[model samples]
Each structure stands twice: as structure tokens, then as C-alpha cells.
Target: MSIFISKEAKDKAQGYWFGLLIPLLAGWGVSTFSMAALMSRDGPVSEMTYVDYFFITGWISGGLVVHPLCAWWVLLRAKIVGNAPCIKGAYMSIKLYILWIFFLLSMTIISFIWGE
Candidate 1:
């Protein structure tokens, strides 16, 4: 097989990788740092402890709690707009929100099983 890769394929791969990587890292960083801070007294905890628990809780909270709240806010905004023309952005947001809900639900189930 040829080793050459097209620029479009390379870009698509990078986009997929970064899209997945950035969210995971963002969730991990937010969860880990926040947990560490709360768990600490003198100062922010420097080392990660109970990493798996933090990651699981972070993803769970982000997907279930945060995502729904954001979706609500979007819906509220749409309501305020009151019969305005359909915005392209809204369709994209709705798709992303649905995907996130499914992903979060799966993650929740996995975490529950794993926890047991």
C-alpha cells in the first residue's frame, strides 16, 4: 500500500483528534483542578490523586449537568428571539447537544458498571 496521505485526509484526522482531545483535556483539567483545590487546605493540590474517579465524575457532571443547563440557556435564548428566522447555528448546536447527551448517558452507564 502507498504511504502517501492526502492533505484533506490529514486535516480531517487532525481535526478529529483535536476535537476529541481538547474536550477530554478540558474536562479533566477542570475536574482535576477543582477537586484538588477543594480537597486541599494549605494550597492547591499539586499532584493528581484518585485520577480515575476525578475523570469519571468530571465527564459525568459535564455531560449530564453542564450540557443540559447549556441547552436550556440556548432554548431560552431562542424563546426570547420569538419566531425569528431559523439560524443555521441553532441546527448545529442542537445536533451537538443531542450527541453530547447520548455520549454522556453511555459514559454514566459505563461509570456505574465500572464503579461496581
Candidate 2:
């Protein structure tokens, strides 16, 4: 009985971890690293404030939300129109990546204008 219960709990936990937690954490990590790298490109980040950190993080989080939805939409449209899934997904992903780069640039500009 204990073994059965343990297995059941593990199965449920796997679903939650894979379906939600993994993606959210991956998004957070990617956003954090990307923002930090981009910010450091202009100069050293020895004196950044909490507000600056949050601003960069928030912007990347917004991008993380937008990027996947937009990609899914593209993939859906491709499926409806009878295009190849692999090709469409790849193309859309690349486009979204470019947009992410653009987003980073815009964020950098905003940060500079807003000041340290």
C-alpha cells in the first residue's frame, strides 16, 4: 500500500513539474541570464539597483510569455493551412528569436534613459 501511494504521488508530481514548473523556471533562468549579459555589454554592473534588476526581469518575462504564444499561433496557422509542422515551427521560432533580440535592445535603451 505504501509503495502504491508513493508511486501515485511521484506520477502526479512528475506531471506538475514537467507541465508547469519546468517551463516557468526555464523562462526565469533564461531571462535572468540574458538580461544580465545584455546589461553587462554596455558596462560593468557593479552598482545596479533593485528597480533596475526588476525592470530587466519583468521585460524578459513579458517576452517569454509573448514569444511562445506567438510561436504557437504561427504553428497553428501553419497546421490549418497544411504547411509542414517542422518547417513552420522552425521558421516561427527564428522570427521570435529575432524579436527577442529586438526586445533586449529596446530594454537596454530604456534602462539607459531611465538611468541607474
- Scored by lDDT, the top model is 2
Q: State the lDDT of candidate 2 residue by residue for 56-115, as single tens digits.
A: 766566456744654555555556755463334445464646776799889999999999
lDDT of 1 by residue, 50-97 (tens): 854565476457644554454445445545754222222344445666
Which pairs clash in model 2?
none
Off by over 4 Å in 1: 1-4, 42-116
- Candidate 1 residue pairs that clash: none
Q: Whole-model lDDT, candidate 1?
A: 0.53
Model 2 per-residue lDDT at 78: 52
lDDT score, candidate 2: 0.57
TM-score of 2: 0.36
